[model samples]
Target: MLRIGSGAGFSGDRLEPAVELAEKGKLDYLVLECLAERTIALAQKRKKSDAAMGYDPLLEKRIRSLLPVLKQNNVRLITNMGAANPLGGAKKIIEIADELGLHVKVAAVTGDDVLPYILKKCDSLEFKPRLSENVSILSANAYMGASTIVPAIETGADVIITGRVADPSLFLAPMIHHFGWSTSDYELMGKGTVIGHLLECGGQLTGGFFADPGKKDVGGLAHLGFPLAEVQPDGSALLTKLPGTGGALTLRTVKEQLLYEVMDPSSYITPDVIADFTTVSLREDGNDRIVVTGGSGKERPSELKVSIGYDAGFLGEGEITYAGENAVGRAELAGAVIQERLQDCYEELTVDYIGITSAHRGSFSYEGIPYEVRLRVAGKTYEREKAKRIGEEVEALYTNGPAGGGGARKYLNEVIGIVSAMVPMDIVEAELQVMEVKPNGA
Candidate 1:
């Protein structure tokens, strides 16, 4: 059996839970799945501003927290913290190891960035209609798979950094490298992919995101521990978490996370293999332990999904609080005033009264009016200055329109929109490079 633990579910996950896993989970690999669909686009924008600023913002902190424990426990680490720049991320890891006076081998998998290829073959690629001829593309990256990571693992690297890849592929790569699973073994690949998906979210499988107050109560939430998977040679796994952690491990939580973000259980596609979740079965082995089995898959996809990001203009937002007897009415009036003032200034605008219609958008019924409400006005425009006016006009409403308006706040942000496309596998190649670090004084 191989034990792989999830260090993080996203870029900003808590560091303590990961530290617990490294020091106590007795893990073979600690994977930190950090990147998301929009994160890479944001990283690309930051990389444009500064050359060495594209990786996960907390990458250094995470490494600093886990390095000593990982080395002490002989646990390897894998992560998609590279974001837009894998080489830069690898170098940062090397520098951190040197500062800590620890010798470690770091590997970076690159070549996922396909912006140049997209530009050269823009008219030829199969993309969504939103990516029209006029749309200005900021970044284009093809989702790579586990194949590129095999060599990195073979190089005996203590840490592996990757760019955008299928979330499950990060976990599957280690299984393949350790167990020597054949690439064509779709059933085994599917089983491994299921383990990856279950562990990818870190705490989701262990009840971090499953609490529903009194209906579905979970304990120790403040110190919730991340999850780990004890996988077998056949790709089946026993899912559990560190003892005394804050969350529960049950079939209900596992089932909920299994279906998360999945459109069709029969045909879940990825860069590595097409997993079939419908065939999977789970059994409760013991307390906080569920034995997962029966996952299957088909051949890998011929064309990889490409995430393309473009400048989607600017977003300006402003909010003002209202209280007293007729707070709802006062909030409505405030929203209307902002709408009437900026009628023709924005391409799109929205007015929502928080604590009432903002969440459900009129889906749920509210019996009584609340004592306080926040009126929020937002607008979208191509020009930053025009967007700024949306907030400025709302700020003016404190003295100009509503009687009890207070706590007014406003800001403008540049929006980076994402679009998806299909690129042939042959066009995008994955490359791996290794770097070894020596003690700074040595």
Candidate 2:
């Protein structure tokens, strides 16, 4: 059996859980599934500024913290924390490993950037909003597959980093590398894909996202542990977490995670295969352990999905807290004042009294008057100056608009929106570049 642990679920996840996995989990591979749909687009923007700054900002810290333990425990790491710059990330890893005098092999799998391919066929794309001349494209990346990382594994790399690979591919790659699972083996492919889907969100499987006050109570949330999967050659997995770690790994959390972000339960599509999640079966094996099986897959898709990032505009936001006597009224009145003054500044405005009605936008109200309320105003505009006004107007509330209003803050940010297009599998190529430290020393 092969043991794989998830270190992080998203780009900004906490670091300690990953370190815990490395030092204590006793695993074959630990994957930091940090990249998200919008994450790489932002990384691309950062890359345009500093070539070496595009990868995960925490890449250095993570690699530094994990190197000694991972090397000592002989646990390999596979992660998409490379974001927009896998080669840069790999180089950074080598530098860190050398500083610690640890000998290890690192490989970067690249070629997910498909900007040129998209630009060549933009006019002919079947998707809507077809490459408008006015739209400024920031980044275009094709989601890579598990097969891409297999070559890196074959090179005996201790750490493998990649950019724009699918989340499941990070976990699935190690499986493919260890089990010798052929890409054409649909049954095993489907089974392994489900394992990735379940464990990709590190803490969710361990009850971080499943906690409720009393309804679905999870114990010891303060030190919630990440999850790991034990896989057999038959493609079945036993999912669990470390002992004495806070958080429950139960069937409830597993079911919720299984259905998370899955629109079509039977037809979950990925670069490597089209897995049928509906075919999956889950059974409780013991406390904090579940046996998963029955996931099946069809052949791969003809076209790989591409995430297209384009400059949307600037988003400006401001917030102020209102307390005591008719706080909701004061908050509403303050929002009205900003609304009347800035009608023509932005295309649209979102005004919310956060504690009272942010969720439904005042469509429904919670019970009883709250003692305190917060007024928030946000809008997006094509002009940065206009966007800046959103924060300015809210800051003005401190002196001009409402009584008892305090703790005002404002922010202005660049906004990048993501759209989807399709690229054929043949057009995108995945290659591995290896950087190694010798067995004797760096």
Candidate 3:
């Protein structure tokens, strides 16, 4: 039986917490997923000169803290925290292991950086690019399937490092490698992959954001529970938490997690197969252990969906409240005034009243009327100066409009600007490249 634990790792602190949980849980495999296209871009900026291996130095520091525990428990781990450079990450891991006198094999999965291959393939196929005006002829990486990770496992690597494999595939690879499960066994491997999905978010399954709404003052949520998976040969898996851990595992908790990111209730696609979520069943087996049974799989799609984020322009929003007779009507007029003021400076500014009960008042309002109203104004601009200017205008309207009679007040405004990209579907398969290091003779 193989038990896999997973954690999301965009930041060092986010994933570092998992090490303690893994050690305490006595898990067989721990997987950390940390790549989104934006994550790659951030890694790129940090390592601008090298253009390949610049990851958050916090990752190295975090890993160094876990090395002793990992060696002590003989617990193997896999992580895509390598960012854009697997070898660079691997070199660091090996050096740390050597210094600590831990004899662990580290394998770097390469060729998974198929940004070049994807761009070349786009020339042959008329891929409909839906994201940006700039032609993304480069750096479009597909969320590669678990197959590429097998070579890293075969290399006797105690720890496998990767780049852009799908988040769930990080956990699935270890199961496939350990069980010698074939890719053709879609039903089985799909089950294992789904197991990874359950654990990916760390505390979601463990009553973090969700719990029985009726249950008050629950036990020991200060530490919370981590996801645990029980796997067998047939690919049927049971989900649970560590023994004596703090959380509940009713059918509702498990089902809530299963549907977390699912866009369609029926067709949930992964690189390996189209998982049919509608057919999934859950049963309570024991304390904190839920049996996930049923649900078969179909063949995977021809293309992969890549998530890319790039440079968008800039945006800001501010809010104010008004309380008095005809508050709702007065708030609408104030909003219109704010929009007209913003139009003078920004061509694309917009405003809306968000929280007032009367925003939805006309729909069915034979009932009691609202005593007060809240209004919000939002603006988007290509230039930061214009965005700030529009923000000041909206706040000025609060104390100077018809609603100004209601003693309106304004709060601080928010502003932001960043380069974002939404990467199209592409593939980054891993190829094993090895070199024999000269031995230090005794």
The best candidate by TM-score is 1
lDDT (tens digit, per residue) of candidate 2 on 1-442: 9999999999888888888988888899999998988889999989999998789988988888889999999999999988899999999999888878889799999999998888787778765445557778888999999999899988888999999988888888888889999998988888899999999999999999888887999998999999999999989999999998899998899999999999998888999899999988899999999999899999989889899888988999999999899998999999999999998767799998988888886787757898999999999987999899999999998889979899999999999888898888999999889998654422
lDDT of 1 at 132: 56
Q: Each prediction's TM-score against the native?
A: 0.98, 0.97, 0.77
**Residue range with the least summed lDDT across 10 consecutive positions in model 2:** 125-134
In the range 304-348, model 1's lDDT, one tens digit per residue, is 999998888899999999999898888898888888889977777
Comparing 1 and 3 by TM-score, which wins?
A: 1
TM-score of 1: 0.98
Worst ten in a row by lDDT for model 1: 126-135
Off by over 4 Å in 2: 128-132, 439-442
User: Which structure is stronger by lDDT: 1 or 2?
Assistant: 1
TM-score of 2: 0.97
lDDT of each: 0.91, 0.90, 0.66
Best-matching candidate per lDDT: 1
Residue pairs in steric clash, candidate 1?
none
Q: What order do you get sorting by TM-score, best first? A: 1, 2, 3
Give the range of the ten consecutive residues with the poorest summed lDDT in model 3: 413-422
lDDT of 2: 0.90
